[model samples]
Target: MGCLSEESPSRSMKPFVFTWNGALALIVKVSIQPCVTLFSHPKEMASSSSSSSSSSDIGVILNELTCPVCSELYKEPTALPCGHSFCRVCIEKSWENREEDTGYVCLNCREIFAQKPKLKKNVIVANLVENMKLKEGKVWLEVEVQDTEHGDVNVKEAMKSGGSESFCELCNGEAAKRCVPCDILCCEKHLKPHQQKGHKLVDPGVKIEELRCIEHGKPILLYCKDDESLMCVTCTGGEHQDHKIVGVEIAHAELKDVLAAKYPHVSQSMQSVASQLRQVQKEEEKTENSSRDAEDSLEEKGRLVCQFVNESVDLMKSEINKRKMEKLSLLGKQREKLEQQMEDLRQRKSTMDTALQDLEAISFLQDSKDLLKRLETMSDFKSVKRTPLPVLDFSKEENNLDGLIMLNKNFLEKIQKGPVEHPEKVAEGPVEHPEKVELDQNNLRRLYGRSPSLDPNSAHRRIKISRDLRTATRTGTENQYRKHPDRFDDFLQVVSRDCFSSGRHYWEVDVRSSRRWVIGICSNSMGRKGVESGLGGNPESWCLFKGNNEFTAHHNSRATDLSLPGDPKRFGFFLDCEVGELTCFGDSRVLHVFWGNSMDPVKPAIGVYDGSVHFVHLVK
Candidate 1:
C-alpha cells in the first residue's frame, strides 16, 4: 500500500504494476528517487539517462495522483473507508442518482454501506501532486497507455515546473524554446536553425511528440481506413500506400458520435431480456404445481368410481343369496312333508305284519273284516306328490342393472367429450308423472290415436303373433320362435314394439274373440321370464283384465272391479305418460282407469289366456 520512495532503501526495488478497470498498464517505476518513474521509448530509452530520468520521475508522480473515475488526475483527492482514493467530484457524481436506502458502494472494491460517508481531502496525496508540478526543470505528465493492436501511445499533458529553466534534447543545458514539428528541445542559441525551416515552435515541456509517429519519427496527420491505424506522411507511402485515408480528427469525432447514439437501445434490449427470463422462471414453477394438482384429481375420481362398482357388486350378491335362501326353505318344507308320509306308510305295514303272525283261526277270523277294510283303505290312500322345482327369476334385476350400467356409461362418455355447449339441453332421464286428467271418450280414438304392433320376440312360446303383427293368439302348441333375451318364458303375453316416455297416445283392441284377456302398458324394464311378468301382476305394469265374467283394472296384484252396462268387444285405451294415467273405454264410456308414476318407457302390452285379440288401427 505504500508508494516507492528514497526512504525505503532496504527493500528490493521492483516495478509496482497494477490494473485500472480492464486496461492493464504500468503504473510505477523501480527506482530509489522520491518520485522516480520511467517510460519505454523504442528509440532512446537506454541512451537518455540523468535528465530523461528526472523527467520520467515527474510522470510517475502525476500518475499516482490520478483518479480511477474520469480517467483524470485527481482534483481534491479523497480517500474512502476502504483506503482506495478518488476525486471528491468524481465519487459524488457516481453516487448522485443512487437511492439513499441502498447506500454508497466503492467502485474499486465493491464494498457497500448503510449510509453515505463524509469525504475529506487526503493531505499526503495532495502534497505529492503539487510538489511534482513545482519541480525545478520543465516537466510533462507522461501517461503511457498500451493499446493491444497498436502498442503504446503517449497520452502526455504538458505542465510548467515553476521557472523558465529548460534543457535541449542533445545537451544537458538551459533551454529557451521547443519545436512542435521536429519534437526538439532547443536553447536560444540553436533555435534559429529550426526556425529557418518553418517548424512550429512552442514553450518548453510542451508534448508535441504525442501526435508523431514513433516508427517514422514524423507527425501523425492521417488515419488509415483499411488498417484502422494512425499514420504519418512516410507511412502512407509504405504498406498503407494503396489504402483509403482520412484526417485523424475526423475519424475520431465520427466514431464518438456513432457510439453515443447506439448505447441506449442496446442497454434497453439487455434489460428487456432479463425481465423475460424472470417471467419464464415463474411460469415453470406454476406448470409443475398444476401437473401435481391434475394427478391428485385423477386419483380421487378413480377411487370414487372403484368404490361405486364394488357396492353394486355387493348388492347383487346379497340379492342372489336372499333368493337362494327362499328357494332352499321351500324345498326343506317339501322334504319334511314327504318324510312324514313315508313314516305313516311304514307304521301301517308293521301292523299288518304283526297281525299275519297270529296262526289261530279264531284270532285271524276276528281281525279279517277290520284287516280287509284297512287293506282297501291302504289301496285307496294317496301319498303327497313331489312338487316341481321352483325357478328363481332374476330377469327383472338384470334388466334394472343393465339400465344402470348404460346410464353411467353414457354419463362418463359425455363428460369425457369436453365441456357442453348447451348444458340445459341435456336430459336427466324420464321425469315423474304429473297429476291425472280425464280425457273425452269422443277424442280417445280421434285426437291422440296410435297403432301399436305386437313384438313376436317378446311373445311366450305358446303365444303367437300373426304375420301382420297386429294380433296375438294363445295357442295350445308352442310356436317355433328363435330364443331371445326379451321373450316371455312363463306368461302368455306380448308387448308392442312402440313405446312412449312423455306424451299422450290412444289405441284400440278388438277383444270379441277372447273371453279372457289383458290389455294395457308395461314398463320397458319389466321382467320377461317370471310369473310376476303377467299383465298387472307387478308394479311395473298396468292393465284392464277380463276373466271369469268380470272386468277389472289390475296393478301390482291389486284389482279394482269395474261395472259396465254391457260388454263391448272393441276396447279403446288412452295413455297420458306425463300424468301416468291409462283409461280403458268400452261402449263409449270410461270402463276403468289405472294410475301411477313409478314407470317409464311404457309400451302397449296384451296377454290372452284363451282365444286371440286384434290390435285395431283407430287413427284416421
Candidate 2:
C-alpha cells in the first residue's frame, strides 16, 4: 500500500490501497522485479530473499492464500457459514464419516447445513495470485493503463471562422496544456495548481475543446456511483444530487467487491448443473453394461429350454414352432411396456425446460425448492409379474401312447404344478419401506388414494382452499365460503370429505410453511356451532397441536407435549377404525397414540393460524 499526497508532496497522508480476495486480503509490502513471479514455488524465493525481512513478507502472503485444513496453498477453496475456509477435498473427507441421523454439519460450530452444499472455486483469490506473477520491468503490468498524449496545443482567443484553435477554461486566453486529474485546459496560469494538487499525469487523449462537458461546460473530476457515469464537480450536486458520489479509486474498489461476491455463487450453480449432467451419463452407461450381462444370462436359459422342448415333441414339429413363437411374443410385450415408461420422462423434461425460461427471482427460487423435493421423492412404479410357460413331461404320455401316445395328460399335469416365479422390477429412483405398515403402503396408497380432499362447504369464512382442494390458507378477509352446519365459525378450520369410517387410514400434512397449526381427526359429532369450536376446544376432536414452537397431542381438551428431539415438516396420522386407536407420527417416528370413538364417520381436519397448510393423501 502507498500513501496519497495531500496539501503538499511532503505532507501527504498515507492512505493504504487494499484489495480483498475470497475471505482474506493480500497485502503486499514492496514492489518486485520483472523476473520475480509470485506463482513460482515458495521455496524458490526462500534462497533469493534469504534476509529476515523478505522471508517474513513471503510467510505472510503464503498464509493468506493457504487453507487451514491442509496447511498449504489452497486448491478449490470453499468458505463455510462459520467464516472458515477449507479445501474441498479436505472438507468432503470429513463429511464422509457423518452419521445419516444427524445430517452433514460443521465440525467446529456443529451447525447443520441443508444436505450437501455445493463446492465452489474461489476465483478472486486465484486471479489475484495469477496477476501477481505477470510483471514487466519494475511495474506490474495489469493495474496501469496508457493513453494517447496531446501536449502543448496552444489556444488564443475564441475560435476564428477560418482557423481551428481552442480557448482556455478559466480566461478565454491561450490553452497551453491539459491537466490529467481535473481534465481541464488552462492558459499556463491556472494549470500549475491542477498539477501541484496531485492531479494524475496522463495523456490528454483528446483536445481541450471536445473534453469539456456538454451540459456543465467544465472538466469532469468525479464519478456518480448511483448513475454509474462520469461528471464534473459543478454537476456533483446538480443533476447527480443525493447520489453516491466518489473518486475513481473508491468507485473501482466498490464495484469489484460486488462482482467478487456475486460471481462465485452464480458460477457454482452452473457448475453443479454440468456436474449432474456428467453423473447422469455415467449412470446410463452403467445400466447399459448391466443389461449386457442380463442378456447373456437369458440367452443361456433360452437355449436350455429350447433343447428340452425339441426332445419332448420331435414327431410333432409344428407344435414346437408354435411354442417358440409364444416365447418371442412375451419378450415383445416387455419391450413395449418399457418404451411407454421412457416416453413419460422425455415429455416431463421437455415441459420443464419451457417453464424455466424468463422467470423472475422469486419465481425461480420457489421453482428450485419444488424441484429439489421432486428429486428426493421416489418414482411411481407398478410391478408386472408374468406367469411362466407350462413345462410338459412326456413320460406319462409315452406309456399311454404305446410308441404313438398323446401328450394331453402330461401337459395338463404340468399346468397344474406349483406357483410360477416372476422377475422383480426395481423402480428408477430411491425406495422407502414402512416396516410397521400392515400392507404394502406405497402401492396401496396409489390405488386407494381416498379423495382426502378439502370439503368446500366445511371451510370457515376466513379459510381459503385452492382449486385443487389439497391446500388451505387462512386469509385476511372472509373468503365467502358457503355457510353450513359443518363449517366452524369460531376457528380457522377445514374438514376433509368426511368419508373415513372403518378399516385403516393414513394421510400426511405439509406444515413446513406454517409455524402454528392444529391438524388431526374430527368425528361426526365434533362441535361447529360457536366461535370456540377449535380443534382442541371440543371433545369430539383429537388433534396434534403446534403453537409458539411447542408441539402437543390433545383430546377432550387435554394437552400433552410431544417430546421429540427434532421438528419435522410433515406430520402423519394413522388411524385404525377397527381397534379404536389413532397414532400420530412426526418425521417418521410415532409421537403419541390416542383412543377415540370411531363408530361414526371420521374425517381428517386442519386449523391454520400463521400461514398455509397442504394435505397429502395416503391410501394405505
**Candidate 1 lDDT over residue span 90-206, tens digit each:** 677556524334467765555776678778788777765544342353332244433222233332322222234376542333677776544456666556655643345678866
Cα error, candidate 1, residue 81 (Å)? 75
Candidate 1 segments whose C-alpha is farther than 4 A from its true place: 1-438
Every candidate's lDDT:
0.66, 0.58
Report lDDT (Cα) of residue 423, candidate 1: 18
TM-score of 2: 0.31
* Tens digits of per-residue lDDT for model 2, 291-389: 998689769866974775566566555555676678778868977877776776666676568558837988888787777576445345455465675
Q: How far does residue 362 in candidate 1 sit from its true spot (Å)?
A: 99
